[model samples]
Target: MSKINKKSMGQFFTPPQIADRLVQLLEQQVGFALDLGCGRGQLGKSILKRFPLARYVGIEKDREHFNHCANLLTEQTIICADVLEEKALSLISDFMPVDTVVGNPPFLEIPISNHLVLEVKDAIPNFLSSGYKMRSEMLFFAKSLKQLKLGGQASFILPKTFFISEQYRYFREHIIDNFSNISLFELPSRIFSGAEVSTCILYFNYRKTKNQQLTLGCIDANGDIENYLKIDSAAAVTRMDFSYHRLMSESGIRIEESETIGSIGGLIHRGNMSRNELVRKSVPHFHTTSFPINEIEISLDDDVKDGIRFGQEGDILLARVGTRCLDRQVLVTAGKRAITDCIYTIKLPEADIDTVIASLSSKYGKLWRQINAKGSCAKYLTKESLLNMPLFN
Candidate 1:
């Protein structure tokens, strides 16, 4: 156990035991490593502990935490600077040719254009006032690639959503072509502190070569690492899935990239009805809450204004609030109006919306409910997550 570093950027420091396991997996790929955005030096310290001879460098921007790292610094090099800033990166390369880069980058939201910003602010306050213009974590990945030499490996723990989100599609495609190997250690929500954000350790080598070993560690609630390609299991190991081979294995599967459907594109949108309004129009408004969902009563005097305002007939309605509306399905009509900020409206061509909704209502939808939904918690399902859904179609 460790005291939480509230002032520390991002999530709390990963517990020592988990830190040890992460380092062990990291070291199996590379000896020398850099810890980007290291806080309190726990991860950097763990690496040095396991591989006493391996060189370790930690970079932190916060002066207080940097002092903490410097106070006990031994065997590892520690520097205080913001990695996003050019000066910090220059200081880092002095210790360069870093075999690996690892850390949990900050979760700052990127700003979107005002048109979208206005739309989101009406529903999502957590979104930056300007909305997120660029993804902070993805920026770290881009910077890592710039820093690393060919064949150099980099690994970091990131929100699992990044793996499936449309926002990260470019990163994935670029890495697949550039990196010789890529491995994912998907961590379930139960492993972390209070935060319920699921994360995964993505490992990849920058160099391109033939005949590379692609290893994947599918972790579950426990910190189990089940190497599907190797048939090896860690202490908390659960079932594993993966095959060692080229980019596309002989799963005998083909998918049309263009035909792919996003939940948002499938007529799924956020639900943004406020509570007072929902209560007042409980009958006429379509709504779902953190509590069980309810149908709104439409009185004889219910106005057409209360019905659909933004979407037309056949648009799909998705609960837009935090985890409450996740996986909740609805059809949009001129008659169905949303009241809660948690609800979003998804509209598609009249010809395709019904088919898409039907698909979303099937086994895949159930799978989504089980895999992505955060149960009753206040989890925000961004359009990125719903739009990046994986399917055979």
Candidate 2:
């Protein structure tokens, strides 16, 4: 497929092996199956091969893919319509309360137009509040759940961020509260040929029951099971709230509980300087960068004083942005310096700044920051998230 068409339509066909694996994870007696964003019907073909009698429906937005799916799976129903549209959802709703739902939904971050946003609100009123920015895959999950019957099950190939990123916090909470038999399979990175995004397969049944625990596992490139861990549902939810690093880490070592940076007499906050104000003041504004920051002399006017994040000699500066958060570039200043909003200033008294920096720069500290940071492309750690970091004595 042309790159332009693929990008515009969010059409990334599932690999045959992965498709078979996802289908195998579903119930053998699946009465009816619906594949949302069923690009070229790879998943549908897998499902039919497993259960020949299974009533299958596939929804594809791209006309070319829809035509291809129609030809490939002539026995099944294939609809060419936007999955987010009310009309399309209505068509699927006709197959209401499907027993099994599965697919790799499109992953896109484009803003939903106001008109389409209203359509989503009307269709799945309680899915998410209006005006909340969310990825296209999340909408697919919500709609899938809405279409599923009680005791129904679903397995979706989702970006790893769905389990950890703050943007999906509420969705994670919803899954924890509402779903049962939850299983997470952490697939190795680059499972998709051209896609760089890390992915995990989420399997859950739409039922309410107590004594719920999650089964977590990792699979290699060839789909071999590596290791598995069973964790209490509540514990899994808590870890996901902070970061998935500990839960998803191959090491599988539990993070030792310790006092947070806030409890250790460290004050953490973001820089508050405005660009216009900082430009005129000529202050040495430190941003999250790989290169060293050059010092710039600034006349400390009252306005500039209020804007610049002035750091003391012993204070630690860390990048608050994604991936960069793991860099653990905790700068122990030789003297007071001007910092920018991209960096977080940590003021610690009575504690050795060097010792703290060393600990945070360790493997454990890197994992902690990775989990706490938010966002997919521009990940970052909020002040509250940074303050919650475990401090070593």
Candidate 3:
């Protein structure tokens, strides 16, 4: 597929090996299966190979991909329709109580400002309780699970954020309250031939009640499981990403119990974006790109200054997003500066903050970041996760 169409559609065709791996994540033999957004039937083919008798149905929305699936899975049902549509979902319910549902859905957000967004979200009742910023992947996931039988299972490759970001806290709690046999882990880089986005496999069974144990894995460099642990689902509901869970499970103490960067006033706030016009005398704002940032300017305009969280001399700035440059920290100087949204700032006494920054830049500190930083590629650090960091002990 052309790179342009690939991104515009938000569909990444699964590699053959990855498809086989996803099929293997199914714990039991499949009697009936459904593949959501079954790009080119890669997963459907795997499902058939694993369970020849499994009544397989593959759904694809894109015309080209649907055509490819139609030609490839001739013996299986290939529906050429939008999986998020009510009609498509109702059709899938025909095979109610499906034994398995598998697919790698797209990860893209719908801006609430769009006129169609309200109608676009009308099909996803599960997300109604959460924020308006709807993600396509989560929509598919919620709908897929609704059709699951009592003991039915599901496996989907999802963006790393689904399991970690606080914005999706509602869904995490939903999973903890409803599923069982949950196994989640980061996939090795380059799973998609050219796409470097981070992703993980989520495999679980549907259960009316919670109390399921959760298994988390850390992938080794060679695309294999390096280490893993099992914890109660209740314990991990707030954050399902492995890194933070592992850190907290082993050594993370509570904000009240531990001496942490938060011990001294905590992270003040994320840097605000430069909202005003940058004229000759306009305040200059530094963002993730302005790293090695010398002291900068905060917007003092009536419209922006109130929201501007100024950086103090003893303040430390950390890049909040990106794959390569994330975790980059800068010690703020006395000069005035405006910070962009991509930066998180903490204010402390100069010497104390310096000591903390030095420790965070240390070898183990790097390891802490390497482990706790979520995402398979464009890794990120959450403010709560950062504030929870243990002081040098």
Model 1, global lDDT: 0.57
- Candidate 1 global TM-score: 0.65
Preferred candidate (lDDT higher): 1 or 2: 2
Please report the TM-score between candidate 2 and the true structure: 0.77
TM-score of each: 0.65, 0.77, 0.77
Per residue, candidate 2 scores C-alpha lDDT tens digits across 1-393 of 886667665656678888887777775388799888898999999888999999889999888889999999998999999887678878766787799999798877657677655554543454554464567876787677667888989989888776765555666667778788888887765677655556788888888767687877776777666767777776665544223544335434444556667767788877787445566777656566622434212122222255467665667777776464445555544555566777777778755565567657666667767656555446678878777766543
**Model 1: how far is 280 from its true place, Å?**
3.9
Minimal lDDT window, size 10, model 3: 295-304
For every candidate in turn, the CA RMSD to the true structure comes to: 9.2, 5.5, 5.9
Each prediction's number of clashing residue pairs? 31, 1, 6
Candidate 1: tens digits of C-alpha lDDT, residues 185-247: 767665666556666777776766544445665665545675444322220122112321111
- Alpha-carbon runs more than 4 Å astray in model 1: 1-8, 27-31, 110-132, 190-194, 210-217, 226-273, 281-286, 289-325, 328-363, 369-377, 380-393
Ranking by lDDT: 2, 3, 1
Residues 204-302 of candidate 3 have per-residue lDDT tens digits of 887655566888885543445767888787667666777766666665444247677776656557765543433333656666776753332222222
